[model samples]
Target: MNQLSTRTSPDTPWRLASLALAMLLSSLGTSIANVALPTLAREFAASFQAVQWVVLAYLLAVTTALVVVGRLGDQFGRRRLMLAGIGVFVLGSALAAASGSLAWLMAARVVQGLGAAVMMALSMALVGDAVPKSQSGRAMGLLGTMSAVGTALGPSLGGGLVAAFGWPAIFLATAALGLVAFAFAARHLPADARTAAPASFDLPGAALLASALAAYALAMTLPHGTPGTLRLALLLLSLVLAGAFFAVEVRSPAPLLRFALFREPGIGAGFAMAALVNVVAMTTLVVGPFHLARALGLAPAAVGLVMTAGPAVAALLGVPAGRAVDRFGSRRVLRLGLASMAAGCVGFAALPFSLGVPAYVLPLVLTTAGFAIFQAANNTAVVTAVAPERRGLVSALLTLARNLGLVTGASAMGAVFLAATGAASLAAADAAAIAKGTHVAFAVGGLLVAIAFAMTLAPVRAAAAVQGERA
Candidate 1:
């Protein structure tokens, strides 16, 4: 059997270091603030719902900018966009650190989100663009591990900093990290051909997506009993505009998202896998910690430690997963990973509320390991499936799916917890209710992952047939 090689050449080892650093910095920002949410709300005297916007605004902005920035990278160059992202992210961090009001903080977060969007979209695309396809799987796996490291470290780091200094320290630390990434990227990242294409920026589509995501995010953050009428209306409007945007893209010469990519089995299936993995991984990431800390009555520090299991396990398993994908195929690795994740979710559902820490920790580690394997395989499959010119858009869409999954899962869980508890705040009574609600959420998440597992099975079979015939 022949090795699958990326159309591009291998990057220097230093380039890989730069990629890892950029990913780590971006991911650290993704969840670091989460651990500091309570402090942020208290400091600003913001309500629970109002405080959610701090997170929501970032998601909305990132979703809006993802495809647009990615397209620009394909046209201009990946390294350029990465550097720009670092600069913009650092500026946003400065703004966030200086902000005194909630509104200002949200606005600052949006800037950071846009910067993150640029980095994330281009980073994934450049990995494929710069490396041999044979090595791309391992490269992507390493990158994914860096992401896991950032996420795993964020909570504990944020909590420690908040306990010592304040929320502003989180921004400062991330800014410093971003600066280091920028310098490394500037020195080591390889140059790509900046081809000018007929594909100009899709401003109209960008506007539509931005408006839609903003509305949807706003709906998610609206406090319960705060008149669902307005929220429902905004959500409905978002749906309508999203439909229009799709129609326009279908007819446009250069669509923001190349819909044709969906026709490819590997690309489409990989994206579905990405979404499903996020649904399971994020549900565990967001709810598990919240439950352990708030529901199970564990200390905040202990909760952070428990939460660390998933990413830690993923980081450890990432390289092996990448090697398997590169040698056999991503489809097989993805299927196995999804199955493991589903089993972990089932474990979560069956565990008694009074289950010991070890029981819970085992499942957490398994689920995280599955997520790591899935991410590494899926990223390689998606980027390698497409041409170099189109990688950024595909990578952007993949990143968008991951973020949207987190946004949707977190919002849905928050709503479910609120409905179950029937209380304005999280309390001891609310803990039991939240635990029950989480079981249902885990079941649903498991089902979602199972579907992806099923989807990947057929693709693996098909790809194997093609490989066999060629052999």
Candidate 2:
């Protein structure tokens, strides 16, 4: 019998680097915006809700487009879509830098979000298209690690840029990075792989999915004091829409998500784990910083610095975590990661308002470490779960799941904190109330991690078995 080896070539390293660069920019837009927000508020003399729209608009665009663009790439060409996305992103950043009005800035942010969505969805998809199946996990892990690095660095970088040169600098920096990444990607990345099956755009499925997500996001954003009956009606209506969307997706000849892919235990479990982990990680990331800074009277830069600790730990541990996944099993790493995350959440929750910065930093480190390991293993599992031919779609679906969790977590946690702190009264900002709210948010976040842990141990066992059989 002939032997076939599965390994990436030396020349392929540049492609991986390009993928990392692309991933970093995609992530940078998300986290960096958080740092620029305070400056944006003061510069525009905007209300809190107006400044928040800067964040919300970017997320809405990215979340809505991530999966849809991925499917389009699969139908057309991955590299082609990536190039277009990058161009659009750079243009948006430039416009963002020049904007005098908050409305214009938000519009530019939406454009940038669309570009980011394409970059994020296609970068990993391209990696899957290029790398051998045996080495896919390592490649995906590296991409995830790069994303973690972007998340870690974004706060500090954004804050520094804002402090030094004002809010426009952040967008300028992003534009420069995007251009550099685009150059590298164009030079180093290979042509997109061909598909044997007939490919066509799934417009109906895409519209349905986008509408469902939009409705759900709107539902979550509605005011707490909204009439109870109206809220109930909206929730029920949203659920019905969700059901209709899922049915349409599953029945469509060219579904955005190949529902059958989840028939494989590994693929399904990996996606679920991805969603839960992101939900947990981001819930803390969003609420913790705001509570510490605006509510607790800490400096914005200090909050950013403190927030950097967790992601920095994750970035440092990423490669090692990937190696561990390859050596041991995803189940073990995932379980341990979730356990550590849960522990950190518990520790964070127990912290009182009087707790000092040093006390918070320690548990934050623990949380970051857990996030690093879980992300690496979870991503590795997703890449390895599918065959090479289907990796693009699978990667897109996984990325979509994670981003969806981010959008959901951000809104949910914000609402919880707002409710707890009585929306932070005009003058006081309510540190004690926010701290109490943060405790509740952290506990909920911990529950998410714990659920992921349990799912990994149980359902994922069968998934591992399936992967082994395929191997």
Candidate 3:
């Protein structure tokens, strides 16, 4: 059956299976490590701030390298690069599992992140390659489910492994899964056709963009206690580098990012909405565990299970959401997604500790379901609008924007939590403090959704009247 992939059509389940696994691995990498943050802090005799880099290193690495790697896939071959990516991920996972010190672990995570970036960037474009345009929505939906599974499943899975065999078991299991993903990818992914116009790699643009993203992500996600002046400097530097990047892109004949392309309705609006939604959604991933563990006094295992509620909703609804996009339209479904997310934010803002986990779980699930629906519609619209040659880069950009949101959420929301609680550390934060922090964070998240809604409103409304708007 594996050998018959060349003879098999693009619509086969196997093609999507490989892409699904890649999405799963990449998504799980962050949250799984998140679940182990406390353990890592204890094991390495480090502070919460120092140990957080275990998660940030991977995100930073992925965020910085995503576009460059995506372009390389476009110029070279997506299948070949994807194979290399899986191998690198597996190698890094093994190294992480065997790391002797916190520094070594963080370094290994960077390596893992680089590979995960390729997996995420390429797996998305590969879905376009593997499926016909008509089925892209459904295929993307399934990919969304796997990503949801990874995100939702990570805490429970990591918790179980940590309980049974300690922190390293998480990476070991991830590495083993990587091997399986590799095997499927090798057998099922489509080989790239030689391009008539070869990709012109934009070395300067890539460097500037990577630097800007790194600076921005670092400034946003940097743990508190850093000198405020330093964080401000990094933020200012990031803005300068970003301006320089755009300046360079405007000049480069073959730019890394196409500025003119983003002017279109679907592309611009889709990117903004995706980023905002992720920024809002990340609060749950970063803050929910603390609320559950400290505010509600749940154990580690219970925290993991409770955390699964939202992601489980995401996974369950992803396919249906995609089908709805196919049957209705992206704009309509996208609006619904935004509405659900807003309502979820409102729910979280008023969450009461006395009601226990169910109160938290219900809102969380609603938010996650909205995320799944939004991605299915927004991603499908964006991918279909771009040319085949540009799909990989566009796909990478979407993933990059989403990554930016996640890191921003982790850092800013964590900061908000810390400030609201008035605690020096999570260890010191009590039920009342945690409750206050969670409410504050969710309130901020809801406000962001309002902003996102404003940005998206013009485009979706224009899309209704403009004959040129892509679905």
Write one digit per residue (lDDT tens) for candidate 3, span 248-275.
9999998888787779876877788788
Better of 2 and 3 by TM-score: 3
Give me the overall lDDT of model 2: 0.77
lDDT of each: 0.79, 0.77, 0.86
TM values, all candidates: 0.89, 0.86, 0.90
Is 2 or 3 the stronger prediction by lDDT?
A: 3
Per-candidate clashes come to 2, 0, 0
RMSD of candidates 1 onward, in order: 3.3, 3.7, 3.6
Clashing pairs in 3: none
Instruction: Kindly list the per-residue Cα lDDT of model 1 for residues 309-406, writing each as its tens digit.
Output: 77789998888899989898877777778878988889877787777576578778778888888888889888878887888888998987787777
Candidate 2: regions farther than 4 A off: 1-5, 38-45, 132-135, 162-166, 221-237, 290-301, 350-355, 414-436, 460-471
Tens digits of per-residue lDDT, candidate 2, 1-471, equal 101115666657788888889999988888888877777888899876678888778877887787788778777778988989998999999999999999999999999999998988888777665566556556667877888888767877998898999889999999999999999989887776665764667777788777776666655555445566775676677677778878887777777777777777767777887888787777767777766685567887788667777777877887788778877777677777888888888877887767677657766778878878887778777766666556556777888789767756766776665666665542355667777777777878788877777776656456457665322
Ranked by lDDT, top first:
3, 1, 2
Worst 10 residues of 2 by lDDT: 1-10
Q: Per-residue error at 116 for model 1, in Å?
A: 0.7
Model 3 global lDDT (CA atoms, 0 to 1): 0.86
lDDT of 1 at 284: 82
